[model samples]
Target: METNNTKMFTEMFSEFENDAEEGQKQKIEEINEILDEMDEAEFYSIFTKEMFEKIDQMIEKKKLTLENAILLLKHIGYHNVIVKFFKFDFHVSSLRFRIENMITEEEKKKEGKNEKPLVDLCECNLLLSNGFISEPIISVCVTYVLKVAMSKEEGEEARKDVEMALLALSNTMYYFIEQKLYLKEIKDIVQYHQEHRNLTRLAYQSVWQFLFCRLLCDRRLEDVILNKLQFEREAIRELEELTKCIDWKKNEDKLKEMEEENLLERWIIALNIYFKEFQIRKKEHVVLIECIVQIYQASRSNYIEICNLCICLLKVILIRKNAEIEDLLKGGAVEAVLEEIQRPTLDDEMVYHILMFFVNASRRLKEEERKEMKRKVFEKLEEEGYEDTIASLFETFDFLNRKYYDELSLDISNYFVNI
Candidate 1:
């Protein structure tokens, strides 16, 4: 039985060693069938050092796709292989670099050819998604991409390289963040691109793509943002500059080039997710929190859809227990909510979101912070000459808190009664 198995493995490897594309598909199919029939333990037992050396030779000779190599490893239950590498303290960086190089070659060949350029990219993504790729492999790819992106004189080829790398990193960021590998590098890359005014649009947007992936996968990215960017004050200034840099004409040109709408809104959604996921209440986030409040204030006058989004976002943010609300109060968040709640044509649902902000803030914040927030809320309402409105809204808040039903009607009624 051992002789037969060894002979079969040797035959399979021999078939793949052929230089001709002719009969390759059939050979691959045959190989797949043979692998499928083999038990996992039996397959794993065949991964001798000689087999890896042969595979490495095939890879070096451009005789194998990284995807197929990965699939083979996966089929053989690659965990033990990784464990062995770890045990021996093998340097896997060269192997990872080879895979990265293979993917880049494939991408370049894809331009005019029908063959898929990013097959390796997709394969790496799949491996990472399945939690199979080793940490060392991930680090190689991420570090390479960051190096390309942060270079002072990146040309067109470098730009393409960085974009592909960023997209791959974006997809795999969850795993990297979870393992806490190379986080400072990612932070530095994002901060440099975000702070630099003259980077390519792709370079700037790549950071947001990275952020979006991290937000989807891990909330702790908020800690990275806070510590790395000091986001509260920086977010405000960044946003102000970002908004000011928008030229309608240039925006239209960008839309034409990218064939996508709502590019600016992507940033908004990412920020909203970060704010929603981690409820840290530090003063650092207050500038951003207040900016959201101001955005709500400005949009309410003309853009109801944006106004609704802002209110809903604020509702999510108010759930954080951190002392961040003090800045919101100082920034006039209460007044913004009050004004929006009493808007003539506002939807009851929007009002409900605004009220829920208060309810959540009351629940999530420390007692003293919540009380101070409440006091400031009322004081701001009075300052805005909405004392009577505050009384009606408070009653509505109580009714909703007590009955916990008729929330929609209560919100609507409160708005009208306040008016």
Candidate 2:
């Protein structure tokens, strides 16, 4: 018993087979219209693995051209209203079969075996950007794109392929993270770009997106990513460069440019993730602490977002027992906190985290070290006129009835006063 949806699909497939080239535009419109009219269950029933296999078979038999097939898929992909209602299984095996065939055909053409390539670069790009969303589909697309992007083939066409592959990968990267797939391959691609430095502007952005996703998804890969790539050193160097170049008070344009680059943001996020599970080493501890203090010393008016991020990272570092409080004091952590607290327009959340950094630093310390830390913190506070800052914050919290801020403020006050 053929349902109306299946019958409609059959009619459309026949039209695609019979007039693969001549009436593709009309057929595509008709197909989209049919899809738009169907309900979710009907749409799924008509567009299943078997249907994809049939399309694949048609391409194999020369009844449907690869270009037309890609066009059809693109239109279907753009059917956002219909697509949002159901999880459209992308029929990965069939798509893989078509892609493999296309690759094989290209190889044959390279060997002077075929007159016309079955699939050209434009069609390949179109197929890849078809908005396929399933895990298996994304995995296949990513694997294919990485292979092509890393291939030795040279020319404008090859470069276009690499660019297109990167665009496709960027679109699917979050899905890759959610599925937790292809960690090593993504790492290799990033490392490849790092060594080569050949990616275009857009491609470079996409690669960084991949790297950031890899950093956030897997904790076990942190050592390999950070050490092999020297990411922390690179991040510190970039931060130092920005601090030298831009006057935070008068360089809004420069800051916007840096924000667009996003290299620092990626590094900060990766470092935050890395420090969550692992203790900071002596070397990283020293450099990162110095880096934070430098940023604080330079920028009080602008870069508050980056400032807040650094403070949060410091909070994480301070929570771990292995981070020596004495090193923090020596590295000017106290001064950095005071600088941030003294900002004219401090938010409640930022204040809470700053106070909590002090709380965490003082936790589990030896009595002698605790008193020493208290002495250093209080001296810095008094030197910077922090009493007025605390008084103002207390009044704000009391007016707003922010209990969390009240509690955290009291904890830091008690910790320092008891010493």
Best by TM-score: 2
Q: Give the per-residue Cα lDDT of candidate 2 at 93.
A: 46
> Where's the lowest-lDDT run of ten residues in candidate 2?
114-123
Instruction: Give one digit per residue, the lDDT tens place, for model 2 in 1-419.
Output: 46776678678777766674768657877776666556557766766767677767877897777667766765554342212334554526476456655555554454565312333322243233334444444454455556655654557777666655554455443343533445566556657766775654445445544555555555665666567766666556656765675556655564344433244444455567556756556566777778877775655556666677777777777776435777777778766875677677888778777767766766756789777767766776686576776676766544334655345443336644564
Give the Cα-based TM-score of candidate 2 against the true structure.
Answer: 0.56
Model 1 over residues 77-193: C-alpha lDDT tens digits?
A: 222321112221112424434555655555456356323334433434323332345564555445444554455555677565555445445444355454355566667666766
Each candidate structure's TM-score, on Cα atoms with residue i matched to residue i, is 0.49, 0.56
In model 1, what are the clashing residue pairs, if there are any?
Answer: 232-284, 281-322
lDDT of 1 at 306: 54
| Cα distance off (Å), candidate 1, residue 185 | 4.2
The global C-alpha lDDT for each of the candidates, from Candidate 1 onward, is 0.53, 0.59
* Candidate 2 residue spans exceeding 4 A from truth: 1-133, 144-184, 193-212, 215-220, 241-261, 280-282, 383-386, 396-412
